[model samples]
Target: MREVVPWQDGPDGDADGPLTPSRDGAAKDIRAFDGALGPARAEGLLSALELLRADTARGAQLDFELLRRSQQHTLDAPQPPPFRSLQAFTKGGREHYGIDPTTRAHFDACQAESTTDGGRPLPLTVRAARACLDVCFFHPFDDGNARSAFLVLVFVLAREGVELDGVSLLRRITFQADDPQDALTLARYIDVHLAETRRSAASLGSQ
Candidate 1:
């Protein structure tokens, strides 16, 4: 079952700011994620994610207007570009998801080495989610750090056999954290929360 995206609250219960995903050209790749989707629908989802990412990266906050437009586009309505950006993400959204220039360089360098040095890559859950979080937090590219971080977690969880819905649990944790120190606390909260929720849901056994 799909789970809601997590992490949108802060200790004060006031959001730092809105978050938006950059539209830096991940639309094509986004389609790849939806293997079961019809070609047209997959294309549309990719476009939406791209637009969302673009607005978030540049503005470092959610573009409610862009997101709304993207959703409308998904519904097959004629719409303007959901958002615009200066560029597209490398390896889809992987390159631009985080916040720092130098850190992004290091990540790309490591990824390059991994490509040829391949043994087997780390499982997506273990490696990618953490990677995304590290970049999102450290790079601080002005916006969408939490959302990008959550997307990485979502990808990892999907690889680990979890189906994520729209709400990102990790996103909520990040939003709730007081600062960097509080992020560790949020991580712990997520582990316990998800495990307990799963257990409870399992006990219900499809009613």
Candidate 2:
């Protein structure tokens, strides 16, 4: 959903540091893989992004169930797609994600934490990065778990009103769930792109 809200002005808004979605980094990543993944994946990612943006724009809480809509668009997800009960192995079967009766419950708990804590909350960057990794490591959906992870990252940032114009560092890269540095690396990646996006936007606004 491409939104068109009046500028946030007449208040203590930054004259040059206004966050703008100037370009769709998620869509760009999908397009780059369209030749291999096809148009359905593109449609799924784009539509899912719309859902995420719309919900965040209206202050809706983040929910994993909403992501099934996008997963269905990208791939043939079973009706209401139940969470996987079997173990999932990714990264050429090197990394294994096990599941039990409580897996779904754990996932929901993690998603609920994606929002602010309202008391000594973690920085938005860490929360967003961890949210992305949750989907990656949780391997929630039977398929498209990577795509789902990426979307969740975007959703987290969108909830905080941040969008990047480029996403080269965020996509198609594999991270280890057990690696201590992976989360830090991801947060750093998001921070780097975000800083550049703000810089580029400010430069454009000045011209």
Candidate 3:
């Protein structure tokens, strides 16, 4: 069942923060495990985990290098990097809308919620993209909100083995969708698209 986390209305009708499994210490531990396992083993473990549609924290538990390797399964080079400082990413997101401190606090609150429970399970591919898109659209930061959120979605989902190109999803959704709602809907469509793509690729290999 989807865990209950109060998602308040984001600024300008956007959705609020994450309310799933916490992963701060767990994420750190995973990184540690990755380091201990070294590159090849870490990558193998991550690849194995991707085949399981489990939780985000379970997957994020891999080491940084392993996480990076897992990311390689889905992402190309020049990946959008996660924000170095949480404060910087949050500040940029809030300032973009010229929001006041109080409202900005709420944005921070939501951001904190996302990280609170390490992360959530993005079982379906499109949902993963949608989560990040929702965060970016609702919390369009002045600095790296879009890029940061995109990276988060990419990395987080990659942990689960949904190796999608963040930029490509953004491009496809923006170009295909007629409106905002349409855009969000298009993101959902990616799930079906990915499944079909994988199926076709497998069939081609068999042939």
Candidate 4:
């Protein structure tokens, strides 16, 4: 299958830079939001994330069906399953192309690689980030693709017993499908949140 986004090799993709949050302010904001939501009902995206987290904790394997359920929970209506029949596109008019026989095979390969640990030689965070990016670029669902992608990332991390303290950068960020740097950037984003969360917990313990 042809690539949806054309990747250009460069220093950005060549070197694995220091893993840090792209925006420190966003991480702080996410922390504040999480702190404020203590003991409250998680509605909408939060609710769906919580559900997916629980499933992951229960050893749910990451696959297409899990993604469909995530999309179903994310949307108000469940008329359409997670898979998109027609051609979809990003908000910036990046066409996802149509899902034909070739597309299905490509997606299946992605799923298999994502679930199996021996499939890729990359670090866990990078692998998880790649899965998330795959969903974003693939644009599998007719709607809620962004949300679905976010949940997939969370599921990947949770499956490995890694949950972020904050998700500020994970949300509201656009990734270039063709850039290999995007994968590393996302892994760094995850690391930033995890570190911050650990720091926060340590502070609480000392308090």
Task: Please give, for residues 1-207, the per-residue lDDT of candidate 4 as tens digits.
Answer: 223222221112212322233333322443465336542312445656767878977988777777777666667454437477787766568644567767765875785565546732455566667788878877787777776787788777667655555687887578776565676677777766666766665677789
**Candidate number achieving the greatest lDDT relative to the actual structure:** 2
Which residue pairs clash in candidate 4? none
What's model 1's TM-score?
Answer: 0.37
Q: How accurate is candidate 1 locally (lDDT)?
A: 0.38
TM-score, one value per model = 0.37, 0.85, 0.39, 0.73
Segments of candidate 1 deviating more than 4 angstroms: 1-102, 109-129, 140-142, 164-169, 173-183
Ranking by lDDT: 2, 4, 1, 3
lDDT per residue (tens digit) for residues 1-207 in model 3: 012212211111112122122222223332455447566544543443442224354544322233233344323324523322223324334333334445544444443333325454223343444455544544433243443344455444444444431233342243211134443444455444344445555566688
Mind giving the per-residue lDDT tens digits that candidate 1 earns over 120-191?
443232343334444343433333333344444433333333432223244434322124434444444434
Candidate RMSDs in order: 14.8, 8.1, 13.1, 6.6
The worst-scoring run of ten residues by lDDT in candidate 3 lies at 5-14
What global local distance difference test value does model 3 have?
0.38
lDDT of all the models against the reference? Answer: 0.38, 0.72, 0.38, 0.63
Q: Write the per-residue lDDT of candidate 2 for residues 1-207, one digit (tens) a residue.
A: 001211111122122333675677777777786536687667766777777778788887766677676566556445556678799999899889999888888888888887877575656667777788888888887888888888888888887777888888888577887665667677778777777788888888899
The lDDT, on a scale of 0 to 1, for candidate 2 is 0.72
* Superposition error at 45 for model 2 (Å): 1.8
Report the C-alpha displacement of residue 51, candidate 4, in angstroms: 2.4
Kindly report which residue stretches of model 3 are placed more than 4 angstroms away from their true locations once superposed. Answer: 1-98, 102-123, 138-140, 165-169, 172-180
Candidate 2 is scored at a TM of 0.85
